[model samples]
Target: MAPVSLKKLVKRYGALEVVHGIDLEVKDREFVALVGPSGCGKSTTLRMIAGLEDVSGGTIEIGDNVVNDLPPRARNISMVFQSYALYPHMTVGENMGFSLKIAGRPPEEIKEKVADAAAILDLTHLLERRPSQLSGGQRQRVAMGRAIVRRPDVFLFDEPLSNLDAKLRTQVRTEIKKLHARMQATMIYVTHDQVEAMTLSDRIVIMRDGHIEQVGTPEEVFNRPLTKFVAGFIGSPPMNMDDVTVADGKLVFASGATLPIPPKFRQSLTSGQKLTFGLRPDDFFPTGHGLNSGDAEAVAELELPVSITEPLGNETLVFVGFNGRDWVSRMLNPRPLPSGQSIKMSFDLSQAHLFDLTTGKSLVA
Candidate 1:
């Protein structure tokens, strides 16, 4: 069945604990990505799952068997590293089949498995090439090919695409997605790039400071972040946040900009309560230029001076002065607004977020 579960997993380096008591589950054939900034213990957690590190606390189960004490090889898992870890002297075919060869598989069987994996990864034509002779993307494919030949119960990838250039990363990302669909094997991927996690994973496990911040599908995490950190970290360009106070039934920012409290939050807030207001660039757009211009009743108007504008082909990222800092907004069907120019922007408060200042948690139920 290959369902994996971590029960209160903990990792400590001597007296300094890194991974706290975190629990997670990976259903068979489901792809999950652990993502966070550096030193979040994501890689450490993955290593623990691979049996490369000792667990300081908690139990890990693959299917129904507890695998805490098993060596990596005995755990029946394969890992693809960012380094591409292929032997420089060996051909791609030989590299892909090395693990089976080490297990004393017959040459014919190794060849067949390697050939199958190569065809699946489209590395058939490059099988004879050495790692140094292949492009970065090809080497990564060969690395994936090596893991595929193992046919393990779980696949662990640690920032496998970070070594590739931007364009190649996208290309290989698509390949990995296809590979998962083709094999339907349980996979756990770790990366710092939220975009990678959002685009590639069935569900994302966002970690921070050795703790899991949130675990949900991409939409859930992006649209309904449970914590202020998750809301800030999940989106592209991030969510625009400002310190705000409840005053006279309105949200008053430090810069004197006042907005009506979102109707859903009005009953929950009281005057003088400190809060943080969050708005994604997607929901803050210029009037007459947003995705839902027809929903005009939901829009709140604001006049702000443009700080800068970044044109991103189909949509433009507009930066304007708000609450003493540049707040970014995404404008569809955009027109250029020069720096320092005052423009009327539309804010879709229906999607706005409110965080309790003291708890750093979302105000939504």
Candidate 2:
């Protein structure tokens, strides 16, 4: 396995720069995921590493050697794409061993490698079946098996499970994780799905506008987002960001409501500070320890009208309007609640996040 590094990498088309001076390091045997919305240059970065795209600047290093001038065949990297790209007419075993055969390896060597990959991917029994005879998940495994047979220094996965159904995608995710564990190979994966990134990555690179927003573990990104975009984007149901201002050394939202700020945040506040207050839905509870007690710092309470309720089997998702903005909160064992009715909601003050209204930087120290 090899450690991959990109130094000040830049990609451009004519005069328009898409990827602007991005640097990344994937340690040997590390599973790193590049996650973001479309057009964030993640796919471009992966393609550049695969030698499929021309890099406008910087160098790509596999181990200690610079591979900027290398071709796809010389890069010693294997890529499993969103589409499995399996040959439809070929049997699973044939498809898996095709690369080896084309390279004129001995028949015995090809058979041994193919058998090993099939066992690793649990496709031993399905080796003789054609692509049309296999399920989506099976085809994905075959694509991965093809990559594994080559034993490339680095494995690049580009949303390999996106084509599968929801249940199949979940199943395949576990399988892929197990494969990585057993192989302990260097991997760099790209996806727009946050759930995939959260579950699969040891470290996730969050990108926006061709720039890295944050790079951290799933828990760090979820529990302690550094930017307003990250705070709102990485979570399910998204974080509620209320436009607030510093009033009398306290954070006040719309409807003349006040929530106390930790002293650590006060140092970064503007004179007539306009900020965005962030609260994750998971942090709010139907019942909390403390309610609003003006001068003393405590959990802030706000009354909001229930706008909609979505029952999600295990839990109910309740949507409400507060401070002229909509917020979604997850509730356990939630019975159906009528819309247009008012209910009191309390937020955990200790779990709150604050961001600069203009700069979008976090106010938390």
Model 2: residue 174 alpha-carbon error in angstroms: 0.7
25 in model 2: Cα distance from truth in Å? 1.2
lDDT of 1 by residue, 93-155 (tens): 999999999999999999999999998888999989989999999999999999999899999
Q: Identify the leading candidate in terms of lDDT.
A: 1
Index of the highest-TM-score prediction: 1
In model 1, what is the error at residue 76, expressed in angstroms? 0.6
The reply for model 1, stretches above 4 Å from the true place, is: 293-295
Where does candidate 2 stray beyond 4 Å?
262-271, 288-297
Whole-model lDDT per candidate = 0.93, 0.85
TM-score of each: 0.98, 0.93
lDDT string, candidate 2, 9-33, tens digits: 9999999999998989889999999
